[model samples]
Target: MRCDGGKPACQQCVRAKKSDGCEYDDGKGKTRTQIMREHIARLESRIKELESPEITTPPITLFDPHAASPYFSESSSSSSHDSPGTTISLSASASPAPFPIGATADLESAHWDGQWSSMHDFPAVPQIGEPFGAEDPPLELAQMLLEIFLPHRHQCGLELHVGRLRESLTHPLSEQRHPVLMNAIYLWACFLSRPGQLYEHEGLYLSRALAAVNDAIANPAKAVDFIQASCLLSVYFLSNGRLLEGSYHASAAASLALQWGLHQIGRDDFVGSMSSERESTFRLEPAKDSIEQGERILAFWQVFNLDRCWSVALQRPATIPDSKHPWTAITTPWPQRMEDYETGEVDIGPGSPTIHAFFIHQAQVSNAIGGFSTFALHAKAAALLEGASRLSSSWSPQLSTSPSLTDNFRAFEHTITRFTTSLLPLHQLSATMPEDKYSLILIHSLAHASMIRLHEPFLDDQVSRDVALRAARSVTVVAKHIADGDFDYLDPLIGHCWVCAARVLISELAQLQTTWPPANTVDIRGELSTLLFSMNKLSSRFPLLAYQATKVQKLLDAN
Candidate 1:
């Protein structure tokens, strides 16, 4: 059997009564036995020293709350006064710790069996008593939390370049830390911890991140980090059901993205390479390299995707201007995986528009060999769903529908139809990586959810009802896979989609009850149950989902 990497002893060995053999290296050449012997010797020496009773100094706390520690801080002086590559330095707690005692007592050994296994146990509740805010958690604990955060990174946004981030960690913390970004990451890491000590420290990190983000906004050097941190904070709030806070941060991120001209990253250059037809609308600094530039591009889309999708979910107007204004247009290329950026695979020459091009020309540039990736597809899916939702939200029987609006609706429906038809079947979606599977599932689910949202108002019409019914059923089918797979963390907005499907099923069930025989009532009830079950399971970790699941259950009960 494989060792679970449990501390002290692996459970497999302990349960088999071979705990004495469960040995480990202490990172040095010494084995566990050697380390134990040295610890005992040290304890004996400490006892002898205590027996002397000659100590005169009073004992002090291990970590001083008032002590200053080196940390990243923006210079208060004018930006122009600083050199081009000036690095900011500040001091705070060098050993800030959120390590609550007895926090890991309930954590199971098997939970570390694999990366996914560890992530599946979020909010595992190690039962913290009181928090010690004087010291920063050990770097080792931060690294451990980071390992847990990486696999679920996409749940927040795609602003991170994994290879670059991992590489940075190898350097000294003083050289690499961006307080705004690091604290934001630490907040997410704490939130994702499963029965780990950091969970209780989420508030501390959140406050630190928020304060740092405010500072970052004023410092031009920290703009990208500011945007990235805002996106993270937005998702963190939304996941915890703080809609107002989430929306505010999302709006801040989207607005700053426009200010930084992130949406037009390659546009000005791409256009300049071809015809100088377009001049830059926003003054922006050039990225140091493709990876830096690519992160900016991803940052825009991350904000765009979050603003668009969550706007629909929260029934609020989207914050990103998208194609609404010339300056606000998203002419940048579609986002790709960080690896593609590192490999220069996304350098598709100049003048090729991605998001806007896909909408206007139905250009399948994203489907092209090197251009296609799951994230690109997901971006398109978000755009399509948002477009359809906007149209649905505006449509009202009281307002006379214009031919232009009707045509727009038809165009949107046609685009959704084509988009969904092009997707791989659920069974055929890439299953090699679990993250890819999750993305594919969301892509398909969003497509179907769009149909329901678009047709929701006209559900009294037979054709619209039929369309919605089919889409709702399809949602259940895909959601069944999600439930069966036992995914704990998901995009919180997905719960809104689940609620949409449940509403359709509930309506169908209510109507079926009106029929004397109630034909196929069991099937409709079963489908609703499937969606509710999935939502409920996820609700254990996501309070937003719990709220959504409760409303759906009440709807079912009423029906």
Candidate 2:
């Protein structure tokens, strides 16, 4: 019943359609709507100044020499040689900028602990013509933000090929560089660059992204970019603990994907009838090349991953339908890496019953598709977790006795066990990149969390408790690894898995308190501490994680 403190309107007010009543006392005595209106008014006045021929004053430069550069590029240091108010552009073929090389702080480095406040002191955004949305950002700023965003792209279901996107950046009006996607990327760049001046532009870029999204709805030609933008916006909201906004955008993305027949890519059979009316109107052809085709496939799966995993985390029904309805059945093959798309190594063949292949074909073998890469494994893990959560939620003492329900539950347990056991060792699976390692950790941890959820309701049964405990311990080990690493980015959903793991540990700790000398008390407490530490670290970026950490701490206090 508590407000999530979302901007413009809290989740409760949004749900009740009473956003007018949502107000915060920041000592300013203004509703969020009022504040937004005032900000819009100022921007509108600024817009008129840019448009008026009578106003010929030159724009002021807002750059600060002492602060981190507004632009990030390999040649950024060269910028100090330029005169004030000079404009710079980077070619897409320019050497890629090293991560956090010129920025004030890396995403997860020591500076993140407290130094980010200086980001506010850097400089105000140059307001001349609102460069971000009105015109494309300078190529250098665009490429820099893209680089900062790419590593964490998976966190928001982005499926664009890095090589292709970078290539498209050189072209001002490339479809790959659509306004919705660009604005969304700029918003994230601002968000992730917490110790740089770009962070100050988060609100500006977010508004532009939202505005572009609305414009995109009427332009079916930009449907793919719209879906990608929606996914990015969803994660932005979710990371800030705004579930209603997150879920709304998430559902929108999935709905658009389905509407465009992304789930049935390469399937000439079902495509004709899937959206006959819309097809006749727009006649949007399938992707023109393998790269575009691969994007469609990856986009569908990204939405699938988001819809499935997040629904479980939110304890809500999933947005994307598969197998439940003929019209919405997913026929897209499992996705390959962006590199595969660029090289034309993608599989464009029609999909077999997609989720079935993972649970049945892949689960039964240890070397299925060469042991499945981390990305593919992540999709499978999400499917298993969603399946377990959905099935378990519908269970009750009476339903548990139903043969069909019991059989389904046992089947999920079996599939998850075999699926997890078949996975390659974490060390072998992960690449040298920290982002790769973080992703590997998340999928494996999520798989274990699935087992925990499947057995959670049956904890009174000794067998169920044993299974759940082992899985919880596995998740705790992953949490420890995550806590010890210097990861610059982490998927916010990982915090939810940690919360589930913490609950099992809390139960064990409670039982241990009943006995003299409390067997394994130190070990349980250590694992619990590790989970809490990881959650708290993550909470620094995501408010929902802070809430979860607080609830767990209170449970520990009560114990």
Candidate 3:
């Protein structure tokens, strides 16, 4: 038979030969080749039918709600910034978690493999009965308590607990009487009070923490103690969202560390009685020591400098003027100074430092609020970040060759690059706000970063893996902390951490599913659901955030 496409079937050949259509002579069956030919012919006709341009489906419009909403809309703008006088209203109808008081602790234990870990776990707690008092609390313990207790105040509503935490800072704590612990408590109090509408309370705790650190610095014997105390306080400040305060503290800590080194030199000179040969050797010692001390001081400042820069970048106003702002003018450059090991000539790291990693984080926050301006900030940050990454390799040799040093430099470079490239598209979103709009800007940025990890040219590089893992872990740490609500006072940035954790978790899940398949997909959805629920709970504080929460819920549900 002739087909519609003008192809003749084998059956016509059989008929013309005066034989049966069936190729097989066996009783009731056609030969395999004959049956295959017919099947092939049917498939070819079906393929043609499918190949023809589809006409029945409606034309997709740029304005279609389903297709267009993700990319454009006005609702996203409102969620970005919290209005000046907005008060968070908690609905009586909202379901309260069982045992909310200890929820933060429980969540933390679950997240960290029940290690009771805290922010200060980096330098492990000193051995008991070795110099420092065995009973005296470790700085890590203080950090843990702050992280665990702070978020619990949210259960009492933002306004009430913010006041209460502020009040707690004034009362003297006799239990764990180390200067560091007290300062940490003060910092936590400041962090919790600042985020909402209470600026006065925030200042009080910050001032108190600073005072304690200053007092410790004045006493020579207590210098090391105070420096560590101050470092912890500053880190807490930065982590808690008191970026300006955090930056100040970080800078102060850097300066103090330098001063302490100088004081040590003075003490050494005062104590030494110089013989002719010893004096000759010692003359060179001061210069050599000064050089080494300077390098070490710069390295020390590098850590907090990054933190300050990141905080400033994140808090940078969404709007940009024709000319750069003064703060941006002074601080936007990367690696403030690059020290030459041999000659001590300082080269600056980069111009227009990439704020991509930082911006990606802010984008997540903006996405949670549905803020287009915030999203745009992220895009700008990403662009700068990209520029910074390109310039990063030039300073690679300036970084110490120590394994730890090299790894950190590589990680920093990789993180900025990956984060910036992923956020470039978010800049393209039109400036608009919609009613009842919510967007997972954080998740989207993270997803973009994760996509880069799975498919990009940098996948094989160790730095990429390190950056991706660190980013993921940072998110996880923030999420786990927020979920547990363990800190005594809540920082405004706690929500930022939650968003970070969610983004990272989702990114990791996506990566695992793609690369590891059946092995990693298990429990993935459950973990995602838990993170989404946490984001939703946190977002309920602001109406804009509530809308964002709803958006996240839908996104998670669809996924």
Candidate 4:
């Protein structure tokens, strides 16, 4: 017998006179060319799969703005001001009137299509000096340095900071040795302290902060410090609109604080504990004033949960008041805690006082605004902040000077500006729907937008218009980021805020198209409607959005 390659077969096989070739010489091995061809075919298949259109659920398209309608119709009349046909010139010649009074008219005239490359102008990154002498300066100082040194570090800085924090957490400093430093580190990780450049970075910072706090907790000596750190981090998360994370941290911090009796510690010795036994054994003497302060911070974080589900008609499975698990108590008022404060005792009242105040104020405003929950929330938030300012000055002198305080105030101011700006558009929408229904929708949109815009201002009119136009285009973008499955990178609560803002924007854009002159009515309205439909589909989860999408659907159906 011979092998396939012409080599002699094994002697035993040859003796047997087997016709089949030896196993070793069967010639089953593939050539290099064949292997490469198979690889290329697999790669090509993969590329085609990547290039294929994603099989998404088709968007609902029930509205057609091009259909003929009587000018007297409610929808047509209400949106008259937005008609592209009625162009409102923004030139000096068009409106010679002075500043604030003519601001609206001026804004209208300046409006082009508002489409421009966003890369044209970006803010300069800030640079801060490194701290003197410390190998690992307090995290707070490090963050402050980052903010000061590279304020506009944007997404890059966020990534770097998260990396550094994660590394530090792996080898935490001795908890008993550096209370102040640890506190600073925890504060740095807080999401609110982060520069609001991109949503992704904010998420990274939040995750890192939570991880750091958890690491601290694992070390007994650092447990108390971790509590304070966690509480601050929770506040930061809530401020930045990461409600789920904020709630998680807030709940953890509040529980730990109660267990450790943090509110009982005297101002002078609060940061000195190291041993778990000693820390656990110490009982706080009730100090009503301090208790109120702690409560306020807690209350603020708690309100985020409520705000997250604000737009839903039916309560979500994860809503705040569901009794599946126990929740922290609502914070009590300051005046009620006066007895503990005057005596310098650790009263540490029922719950988070500051957050409670926020909710109370929100509820009051909601009741008064005739169901304009958003408006009432903002009005109340402003009031709560103003009240906080007064309380901080009286109860905690140092807090009044704290940079964190200043940051919070700035955030509050931004919130007010956003809410105030939304009033005009909301009022315009209210004219179309039933008074009560529209009022509720308008308030919700106003409050939600105001809250979000507080941090990221659209200072430039053109930029604002562009953002508004994008918002009008489709709710899909909003839904993808907000209501779509768990995107750990986004603050779920803040996502809701964005959804509300986008809804308002779409409504305003539609109104603008209708109110403009008849010259470009057909084209402009068509474009605006397409944009609006896209936005509507995206925000379909938030059915209570300011504009009556069902009305648009009916209009589409009629056509």
Evaluated with lDDT, which candidate comes out highest?
A: 2
Candidate 2 structure quality by residue, lDDT tens digits, 504-555: 9899889888998767688888889998898878766555576567667767
Q: lDDT of each model, Cα atoms only?
A: 0.66, 0.67, 0.35, 0.34
Worst 10 residues of 1 by lDDT: 110-119
- Report the candidate with higher TM-score, 1 versus 2: 1
TM-score of each: 0.75, 0.73, 0.29, 0.29
User: Would you give me the overall lDDT of model 4?
Assistant: 0.34
By the TM-score metric, which is better: model 2 or model 3?
Answer: 2
Candidate 2 lDDT trough over 10 residues, lowest sum: 90-99
**Whole-model lDDT, model 2:** 0.67
Model 4: per-residue Cα lDDT over 427-500, one tens digit each:
34322212222223323433444433332233234654554444333323333322222121222233333443
lDDT of 3 by residue, 338-400 (tens): 112223542222222124324335434322221232222333433433333333333433564
lDDT score at residue 98, model 2, on the 0-100 scale: 15
Steric clash count of candidate 2:
0
Query: What TM value does model 1 have?
Result: 0.75
lDDT-superior candidate, 2 or 4: 2
Better of 1 and 2 by lDDT: 2
Model 2 misplacement above 4 A: 1-135, 174-176, 269-283, 362-371, 398-400, 427-433, 483-486
